[model samples]
Target: MTAARLISVNVGQPRDVELNGEIKQTAIFKDPVPGRVKVVDHHVDGDRQADQVNHAGVHKAVYAYAREDLDFWAAELGREIEDGFVGENLTITGYDVSHAVVGERWRVGGVEFEVAQPRIPCWKLGVRAGDKSMTRRFELALRPGAYLRVVAEGEVGAGDTVEVLSRPEHGFTVADASRIFHRDRAEAARLLAVDELAPPLKQWARKRLGLELEEEGG
Candidate 1:
């Protein structure tokens, strides 16, 4: 298969916006950067997450969404969607982000990244789309994109070739993660097999398997 390519590098800062008649601060409004940008351990150099408590972390330092998915949405919504419209840090082409497996390592430009988990839609996404049901729709569509952890800090820019260096044997993919998060709560073993998954996802799996209370008590 041909190498996947980074279509755009996007960055944004937190800003206040009115959503559902309430003032809210969000960093979902991103614009493509013109040149190479630094990829750090915690986040991209020019990007910031408004909700540090839930959004920004080592496990979710960067978000990648497929350009094809954006095109799909554009057709579905009957409107043009730009590269960073979905709040992705990296807009990628030639690969299915939803099929990315946890622990899969990708080398892009000079940086290396690991697939950490699938994104879980929040109210902010719905607000950004100007529809309260957008979150539910995103969850149901099961194409919520993938979050990545920076394994090696380096500079990256648009048109960088993405090389897959490794993939885990567990076979747990981002689509499977989304299924476990949304519909299939019985796949605890599959969820646990992805050892590199974020702690929150692991906890969700434990809860689905009725092990959270037991583990907590012990």
Candidate 2:
């Protein structure tokens, strides 16, 4: 059995959104996304003015390792490692976290979360990277990362171990879902049926597949 490794976990408060000279709450996995709980707005240079929505709620987003990356304004930023990412409420390294398909389930500590959707890179990441092109880099990787829908309803902290509890029957990994959803909608249709997609993802899939899921009879 392949074991998923817990690489690093990070949580931080928005730099610009300060009150009385005090930092707000550190962002968490289930934190409310302004209008939505699962959705999060990202900024590159710690600038609140340059934020955008690329990754939808409950979507897992991944950032790759790049050495040439440098901060545009280093004075205002916090400690960042070469291969580490800061936006995600939770960070993971091993266990092919990015390749997890929708509908697949995993457990972290006592909390259970399921892969909801493949993340779509937004402008906020570009700001974070100090280069708009970095957004494309993340998108090109296709392993942008993943979002987990809480199943057990529990609080998760850094250093928690994640365990794979179930994998989808179709075997449609996150990478596959990203390509199929954009390049080939028909194939995506098949995946949505089996994948545990988030609301936005499910909506996208239903429209692309032209297969409306009938509600179960009461």
Candidate 3:
């Protein structure tokens, strides 16, 4: 596969927002930052997640979005959606990491990351898009961006080459996970065997397949 390049490094902090007459904190608003930036096990140096329980963790450390996907949404939405506008910490060009195999390993500058899962859309996503239906539309679009776990903490910058260091043999892609979750419910079983599949997905699969109790019994 052709190499992909990092288009931008974005960061934002959680802030209070009024949505539906209720005050909520969201870190979904991100903007591109120039030059190199530090990356850690939990997040990019200055980035944060509003929901610590679900959105914050080593498994969901860095969120990545494809510039191609961004353009697609821009054309579909009939508006210019800039890089990092979708709350992705890394905006990439060329290869859309959306197609990356589950547990695939990639290197950006000195940072190492493992493709852990897709960025499952939520209410914050809709808020970021300024459209209440964006969360659902994003699911149906099947362009779910990638969430990467930090394997080796370091620094990354715009224009860095994204090197595919290794790929998990399981063959499940980030987009595949999104599709299975939203449209192909039956494929949940296939994900159960993938050790690198996201934890929430694994749990959902076990429950859907009625194997949760069986696994617990083992």
Candidate 1 structure quality by residue, lDDT tens digits, 1-218: 66789989999999999876889999999999988999986798899999997898999999999999999888877899999987999999999988998889999999999999999998888777887888898889989789999999999999999888999888788888898889987776677777898888888778778776755654
Q: Which portions of model 3 show Cα errors greater than 4 Å?
A: 213-218
lDDT of 2 at 38: 24
Q: How accurate is candidate 2 locally (lDDT)?
A: 0.50
lDDT string, candidate 2, 63-175, tens digits: 21111221221322444533244265454544565677667887765557777766666554655555567566665656546666656654344445677788877777667
Instruction: List all candidate RMSDs to the true structure.
Output: 2.5, 10.0, 3.1
Cand. 1 Cα-lDDT: 0.89
* lDDT against true structure, model 3: 0.90
Q: What is candidate 1's TM-score against the reference?
A: 0.94
Candidate 1 all-Cα RMSD:
2.5
Error of 1 at 9 (Å): 0.4
Residue pairs whose backbone atoms clash in candidate 1:
none
State in Å the error of residue 25, model 3.
1.1
Ranking by lDDT: 3, 1, 2
Give candidate 2's TM-score.
Answer: 0.62
Error of 3 at 161 (Å): 0.2
Off by over 4 Å in 1: 214-218
